[model samples]
Target: MAVSLGVFSGMRFVAAQPHSGNLLRSVTMAVHVPRKGLGKPGRLLVTSATVSETPSSPKVRGIMKPRKISTEMQAICGVDEISRTQALKQIWAYIKENNLQDPENKKIIICDEKLKKIFAERDQVGMLEIAGLISPHFLK
Candidate 1:
């Protein structure tokens, strides 16, 4: 193995290229020095500096994945399908626009006529209850 060291942009880089005795199968790897407050002490990051592998698109799973929504959810999100994160964003936008949050306790939501439709006609709901209350609106 052959090793080389160099510095770029105030960061030190160490390259190691494996030497083959018979066949030519050399792969160069770079040793990455940890940045300030990145990782624990005495830790190093390594990567293939010479390789340029195209990254595959990330999979959409969990709450980020869009799914079919009920009519009541559609009414608030303005879309027939949406991700939980996006749905929450739309609901928060509606709440902020209409000033539905209680003035005395900001965490308390005073459901108006529009929110009541989705909140199962509940007169008021807590901030934490929003996620649970809206879950049914997302069709399985």
Candidate 2:
């Protein structure tokens, strides 16, 4: 049987059981090439040794600290201090709670009375533009 692992950290792993001598071997290969407009380049690391142990769980990275929400946003989000992610989550929850999604086009959010104040009195706004629209409601 042949087993192939998907890409991880830009590397691929392939394990095959060969009929010759009934041998099993695993091969890991990767190539690192920097691309224009991409982030920093990374080095290629390869190891031939095989261990029967499973890989360790990836570390959980810390998120950005909560920031003070502007007075206008605080009223909308019902929180004085909130992270950008949290604020967005609250806004999404509010929209869902009120069923603000357009019946015809789900991509559009119909601004309610409360949302109208935060959305600059716009009757309708695109879902993708929510982040940009709420940006001004966050304090630096």
Candidate 3:
């Protein structure tokens, strides 16, 4: 079996086990060090290693779960309750259906009659701003 590990500082280490009856036998290891000078190439060094257990997966903390959409958003999305992801998907569907994207710059969404009400009467809005604009319609 082979295992690999990497560090953010651009160092990579790999360990491989050979087919042998003894588990504590010498293992093959390689270390890759990045070049320091500009346009220079890196180097790989091979060595031997001892036996050890594999590292476990890191634990993820403080993940925020999806919440239900607000009443106004629900009305706009035509659903009683929906996730934020689903709300965005529905809004994109509506935009595509109405050809609301600006022909000159696709990032700009040209608001139509129905979208004007949701977009605060703006004739055009950036695609990235759509989330912030619709944030007020969502429930806390």
Candidate 4:
């Protein structure tokens, strides 16, 4: 593996190109860096960057379809019924529509009633804190 350092959009990442003796197999790389509030580190070496063998599952980008919510989730989310995915979508939509997102930082979400319930009555909450708030409302 050729370990090369690359900078994209001011962010640093390690890029590796796979090699077999003298031949270039395929470009396989992994992102190794930590963003704020990501809560964990990302992988370093991407063993397989290029897919040359039989087809594997295709990669899907963008927001995932909201999962159907149980009855309990609706009460906490301040809605009658919703999917976990959908509820998040609505929450996000509300955040965007009302411009409740913090101006200083995009990751910091300013809370209103919709987000307040999701935040469990907290005066303020970070985007990273969202998971912790949602976990309680979800059924085991």
- Tell me, by lDDT, which candidate is best: 1
Q: How many backbone clashes does candidate 2 have?
A: 0
- Strongest candidate by TM-score: 1
Local accuracy of candidate 3 as per-residue lDDT tens digits, 3-35: 786543555566676666654544545564655
Residue 20 lDDT, candidate 3, scale 0-100: 66
Worst 10 residues of 1 by lDDT: 17-26
lDDT string, candidate 1, 1-140, tens digits:
65556756535565444444533344455666777787787886665456333345778999999999988788888989999999999999999999999999999999997799888899999989999888888888
Candidate 4 versus truth, CA RMSD in Å, comes to: 15.2
lDDT for model 2: 0.71
What digit string (tens of lDDT, one per residue) describes model 4 on residues 1-140? 65556855424454455555635544545444555565454544333345343234655433342334445456545666445566676667767878887898888887776566657787678877776677666543
**What is candidate 2's TM-score against the reference?**
0.54
Clash pairs, candidate 3, are none
Error of 1 at 58 (Å): 1.4
In the predicted model 4, the residue pairs found to clash are 28-49, 66-85, 67-85, 69-83
Off by over 4 Å in 1: 1-54
Report the CA-based lDDT of candidate 3 relative to the real structure: 0.68
Question: Which scores greater on lDDT, model 2 or model 3?
Answer: 2
Error of 3 at 95 (Å): 0.2
Query: Model 2: runs farther than 4 Å from truth?
Result: 1-63
- Cα lDDT, model 1, residue 134: 88
